[model samples]
Target: MSLKGKVALVTGSSRGIGKVIALKLAEEGAKLVINYPVADEAESAQQVVEEIEDLGAEAIALQADVTAMEEVKGMVKEVKQEFDTIDILVNNAGITRDTLLLRMKEEDWDAVLDVNLKGAFNVTKAISRIMMKQRSGRIINISSVVGLMGNAGQSNYAASKAGLIGFTKSVAKELAPRGVTANAIAPGFIETAMTDQLSDKVVEQMLSVIPANSFGQPEDVADTALFLASEGAKYITGEVIRVDGGMTM
Candidate 1:
């Protein structure tokens, strides 16, 4: 899975699954661009960049709100200036506004979709323009198991992720001729700060459904992203690989 001389941009990579994915790519010899949203997250973003540097890979942290097209363009422009070209893009930034359909606020739905689905579109479109010229690139989107099998309190989240699956497939078809591959990774219950917010009862419910009897880790999803980004997956596109503990199956 050597990515020597490749340049990878992982959005929302300051922490959790995104951070781990960035590290995994760095370990594979890819120079990294860690993307976080807010100024307050600069410290953690720099920390991740330092960690990648420690691994003997070049890395820098950039901030951009994926929901905004201009900001996304600026981030990609900066990356092009620094790396010359992008070889890999991981759309790992997402947020949840969990609530039953009846109780879900309009803002919650919009926010989740903006960051999870529209954000991927914004970043992918911007990066694809660059990749089209390069004629070779990897786009790995981080989806979720709930998107496969709907959840009660996560209607908005599920919708956003389901949207990503469709978007991934479409991009794969559109970019494949140019040798740009796009795929989605749907993870079950990954042990991340996001999952930490679940109540004990909710956790128990999830565990009962998972055949693995244990939750997954961020590294698990990161490894999958690594595979999708590697040369080994050159022929794989428009596919969704699940990292859930057999929860959806």
Candidate 2:
């Protein structure tokens, strides 16, 4: 297994892309720390943990709101107690408050920025310290193609994701010397709970523009993430890989 004996903490991994990432990493033999913001959703987190255990790997679910610094700290503390160190950190917790600029509320903007951008900052800050000490780690931030190409009615979401790209680059530069790598995955139109809300006509319109002529799956993003976290990608950092199937090209 490529990740045998490694520990990975994936934030907001209760479902969707995050869940897939966690499972994929576990399949590669990484011990898993699954985090969820919603305390009531322990069952969702537990399901992932059970699956990992069934694969003969260790797993644990942690409840922490990534937007809350205190909660992030607590989550890190729990992971440290169980695993001692984190080799991979996936900042996958994000939320979108989509609306046109004219109708977007201050709260909407703040909420999106806080959860999508600041949440990554908080969790990465907490975990990078241990990684820097170990002199090795992989940090992958989940971004979106909309952050690169921009999209109507999603100004706040786009800004938060774009901000992640800049933040990922800066963090990568700062941590490179310590053997820590930070990168971003900008997914185009991945078929997830987020995209399920779009009508079939809307999806058809999107597919017309995408060269691949299909929506990306969560596993597609997870596969890219697994490669980035592997030794093969050790030298790669501060890069935003578009898993958009040529849509951004």
Candidate 3:
């Protein structure tokens, strides 16, 4: 399960699940490029970079808005300058703009789609050229169960995540011949800053429905990401692996 000598780029890795993913990959001996949008806290991103370095894996943090193609291109360039080649890409940067369809603003819808779906597209597209040249790569997109089973007050978020699933399958087919694998992870109710904002009653009610009867930690998602990025998952692609504590079932 070691990724010795491999280089990975994890977007939105400043904190939460993304941060844990980067750390877990580093623990598995992968050099990392941590990407965070301008809106993310710099301290958190830097902390991740330092933590990876402390673990004896090389790591660098780069700021870039994933929704912007040019920014994503620049981010890839920076990563190339640092690691020369990227063997893995984790499209973990995403945002939720939760609102009922009737109340969802155009800006909210566009913003969520732009960052969650288009952002993955921008970063993956930029890195595909390098991966194609190398004839090997792994792409893991962070999707959500809400996308699979529609949730109330999250129309925009659901649409964005659902789009990722379609994009993952399409890209996997396109890159399969090149020895590249693309997949999506649909996580449900992971404990993070984002979920912390949920009302206490909402969280309680949600937990009651989960078979596990508990919320998932960031490491659970990170472990899944690490496996998908490993050699063990080479034969698996164009698929969505749920890390939902059986909630989706």
lDDT of 3: 0.93
Please give the RMSD of candidate 2 to the true structure.
0.8
Between the candidate structures 1 and 2, which one is better when assessed by TM-score? Answer: 1
Which residue pairs clash in candidate 3? none
lDDT of 1 at 116: 99
Clashing pairs in 2: none
For each candidate in turn, the TM-score is 0.99, 0.98, 0.98
What is the C-alpha lDDT profile of model 1 across 202-225, one tens digit per residue? Answer: 999989999999999999999999
**Residues 77-179 of candidate 3: C-alpha lDDT, one tens digit per residue:** 8888888999999999988878789998999999999999999999999999999999999999999999899899998999999999999999999999999
Between candidates 2 and 3, the lDDT winner: 2
What ranking of all candidate models by lDDT puts the best one first?
1, 2, 3
lDDT of 2: 0.95
lDDT to native, each model: 0.96, 0.95, 0.93
Point to the candidate with the largest TM-score. Answer: 1
Q: What's each prediction's clash count?
A: 0, 0, 0
